[model samples]
Target: MNESIKTPSVTDEASTPQMKTKCEHHAECMKVIQAILDDQATEAEKDHFRENIDKCIPCIESYNLEKCIKTSLADKIAKKPCPKNILNTIISKINS
Candidate 1:
């Protein structure tokens, strides 16, 4: 028998406050969002992101919007491979 491991989705994690620290400003929230999306955020940064999402309605909405867009694009790209011509064209442009 095979067992599957379950991981929390971004929405799941964002739905609750994992830490008590409340973010003070929108700019700070945006920075945390960028870090999280870039996968360059430390654990503390991630904690701040989560805390802000829980404490700030604007942050929660922004996180949800970004997450939805990212997930949607990833799903679409996974289902459709880029055409070789377009890929080569992009490579050529980069090399130009």
Candidate 2:
């Protein structure tokens, strides 16, 4: 006889807070995810959000999308300072 291994199913309510529901609306979950990535969420909050995100596919995808946006913005903000000589040359070329 062949036996199948049983795996657990993840429901949003299983990981979400008592006040929150894993229903059709996801704006609240997305807010939690944003706070998580921003590091504004406390450890407990982070854990709660992470747990919920781990279970909710839509929330997980939204988190990943937001994370990428954060990464891209950070990259832009951390761009290397322009060299003075390069800037001067560009200005000169522009004026020519």
Candidate 3:
């Protein structure tokens, strides 16, 4: 037996009701979100994101959730140090 998974096309994904209701600027919003996460967004992109967040409830909620998750993860990592022994072991394994 053979099985395959089906992936939705960009057009199909963009046409969903949820996507439509979320924001007409969905593509731009996503680009801004990704750029912000990657720390590569320009001032214009940041401004665009800020503007959309004010006008789009869904965009604001999504942005807030992502920002919360990212901040939580960074805070947790910053507070936790890897043990020296574990770090050395991993380094040695990689060197081998």
Candidate 4:
């Protein structure tokens, strides 16, 4: 009697890279990401984000987190009513 064994495929041994943000410019990265999403970023900021996104995983993660926060806040703002008194208060604070 003869027994045969099948070889495992390369995919069986292959590992996936961890999805993580490794960027050093955590604050700047998040700001850039937010600015991009909001369409408030300048050309220079866009360049910065593009350059660092590939190199820094931490910053990328931070960027994603900031985006999530911004989206959530936008949804919240959409749902809530801005009281006129509160609006006045904010305007007053800004003017002060």
lDDT of 4 by residue, 1-96 (tens): 335766656775465334444555567777778789899999999998787776677876677887898889888875668899999999999999
Q: What is the TM-score of each candidate against the true structure?
A: 0.52, 0.53, 0.54, 0.51
* Whole-model lDDT, model 4: 0.76
Q: Write model 1 residue lDDT over 1-96, tens digit each, in one string.
A: 446866789998988666434445878777788779878899999977765666677787777888788888888875668899999999999999
Return the clash pairs for model 1, or none. Answer: none
Question: What alpha-carbon RMSD in Å does predicted model 1 have with respect to the real structure?
Answer: 12.6
Candidate 1 least-lDDT 10 residues: 16-25
* Number of residue pairs clashing in candidate 4, backbone atoms closer than 3 angstroms, sequence gap of 3 or more or interchain: 8
Estimate candidate 3's alpha-carbon lDDT, on a 0 to 1 scale.
0.78
Give the TM-score (vs. native) of candidate 4: 0.51
* lDDT digits (tens) for residues 33-83 of candidate 3: 878987999999998776666667777777788788888888887566889
Q: What is the lDDT of residue 53 in candidate 4?
A: 76
The ten-residue window of minimal lDDT in model 3 covers: 13-22
Q: Note the Cα lDDT for every prediction shown.
A: 0.78, 0.76, 0.78, 0.76
TM-score, cand. 1: 0.52
What TM-score would you give candidate 2 relative to the actual structure?
0.53
Residues 1-96 of candidate 2 have per-residue lDDT tens digits of: 546865545775476645333536588777787788888887877877757765576776788899999999988886689999999999999999
- Ten residues in sequence with the least summed lDDT for candidate 2: 16-25
